[model samples]
Target: MTGRFGRCRRIAAALLTAVACQSAPPARAATPPDTTARASGVVTWAASADRMGEGTAGQGYRLVVHTSTGGSDLRVRFTNAFGDRPLTLDGVHAGLRARGAALRPGSNRPLTFGGARTVTVPAGAVAWSDPLPGRVPAGIDLVISLHTPDAAGPATGHWMAMQTSYTAQGEHTAEESDANWTRTTGSWWYVDSVTVRPARPASGAVVALGDSLTDGWQSTTDLNRRWPDYLARRLTASGGAVRGVANAGVSGNRILADGAGQAALRRLDRDVLSQPGVRTVFLFEGVNDLKAHSGVTAADLVTGYREIARRAHAAGKCVVAATVGPFKGWPEWDPAGEAVRQEVNRFLRGSPDFDAVTDFDHVLRSPYDPERLLPFFDGGDHIHPNDKGMQAMADAVGLDSLDCAR
Candidate 1:
């Protein structure tokens, strides 16, 4: 049921063996013209910019998502979309919530840089760790925690893949919050994406994109209860088409210009368009632009919607657009935001350019109001859907829309 790696050998031995193999293997000559950069080395996932623990709050913090079992040969990704000077890190460790919701060394490591713990990940770059004895599994969730004891501030927050992250007293709270992270330390700027060479290709991946509702903010951590995670399980069990899905939804992503990190339009070239063998794009995103930017007109949003449709069609990729769900009673939400959402939904329901479509609005709407999120499925944040609501959204997508299924 599990795979294991041979025990760890010091770096010197590894270098000595490589030096000897240089003769036996006959060095793979550099600059070979026939070389191809395959997808194998490229690990793809999504991230968002959120409010990390910052301010006079003394407890400034940020928790990026990472795989629980990707082995010690792995690298950690800390992010900072906006920060001054080269960000720094004190220490880094791989841990898990060992019951009581406490952090434990699920895989305690000698996390180092150039063979040391302290390193500065220059602004806008990702760092990788030297190979160690750690090998990871697919379903495992890891707590890639970053801690800082210095009063120096590099405050930039983002949406973490896990549901929630707890903090202790000082920088050590995150480290000591868990019975195991007693001596924890690490910090940096942008931990955007982590990469690990998977032993084999993933069964399959579905890229789910949308607003906060699709991101699953209030749900429990590492549970993968987001409908996309649930759908991954359902697909594997059915042994059917579209083997698994990767949630590409960012908390406040928009369809047009950059509202949070990159607008859906700019991100599409990366998120939907460039995804590897992405079977289908469960397209949904647009509410934040209408809600957050009061100046954006309904007509402008529709124009952006049509542009998405046109580009996806050109990619020869299958498309499934979900009607924007409800957000009426949100604390700062305005009535104008509601009307813009309706106009965009009307365009999506038309299903003109998309290869397939689903009515996410219809799936979560209360027949009584039709425009508001159904009471039972609302996670109280009129903007995002509850866990159950996420399930409903996934179910409405239906297996029939996927080409691999047919």
Candidate 2:
């Protein structure tokens, strides 16, 4: 009996040892966080800057602008490009617009430069604000309130905003109410561009380099009805990879000469290429150059186009050309200018210098009279198109072509 009990105990011990000797399954390595969609940054909204007028010290500007693409980490760029002296901006805030000169409750936030609320931009230079936390939705009116403590000399701003902004005598940038902002202005001060970090790293922006037609001069004021605005809406709705749109148009701007503003060629670097994540440069100017009878032949205009294309290509950006629309009834229109326009259109249609071509002339011309704007689309100027015509032009753009590789 004793021998049998000892043998049973040994067998039990052997079974326990066998179970402990077996190896356990290895634990799975923790899954790493996905960062493929994280974006570096992209320009969501922008306007071309020009010399507005003399700057007023202690004056606050509540500039309202429409955003094209939505994202987080908002940033603003202030320009002193045309200033002859250093521009000191003490207070700046950005918020969602509730109404005229009023911001939505809890939306107004102070903007900083290098972690400070104040920044001094040197003469003929620009400054970019540090990124602000929070997300901004697309197609919304963004109100930027800023105060210049020592803004003297020439003020660098966009002259024709179409949208009305407000002004106050003191530093009213922190206030969300419109009571302090009693004065109205038709220009955007200092601030030129706004950028956001999109969810997709592949997201990019397109800058429309043109004249008044692209600037929404004839479209209804306060409404974002420009062709570039329409294009932005279309891009958002279509869920395209290229979603941002920056309008770099100036009223009466020319391609070859400096008149109303710096020529398109001269301002290309500051107005278009300098914007973050710019994938394409959409060239649509030339009408003003030909209509002015500045001895700018089709060949000369084509050379300007080629130079723009070459510079854009050097910057690793795609170039898209648009044919000039018809304007037979315009006072500037003449047989000589019409001939130049036709020749330029032909070259734009067949040019290999551009990655893509948009035939704006074909889209805007009247079927009854090919040399004139469609009466339904004309804004009564025989040159600029109304809102409907602007939408049509935006609709005519091929979404796929905008994503061309450089």
**Highest-scoring model, TM-score:** 2
TM-score of each: 0.67, 0.90
Candidate 1: tens digits of C-alpha lDDT, residues 221-314: 5566676766655665565445535566776777776766578877676445544445677778777787854677778877887787677667
**Which candidate's lDDT is highest?**
2
Please, what is the whole-model Cα lDDT of each candidate in the order they appear? 0.55, 0.87
Q: How far is 47's C-alpha from truth in model 1 (Å)?
A: 2.8
lDDT of 1: 0.55
Error of 1 at 123 (Å): 1.7
User: What CA RMSD would you report for each candidate?
Assistant: 7.9, 16.9
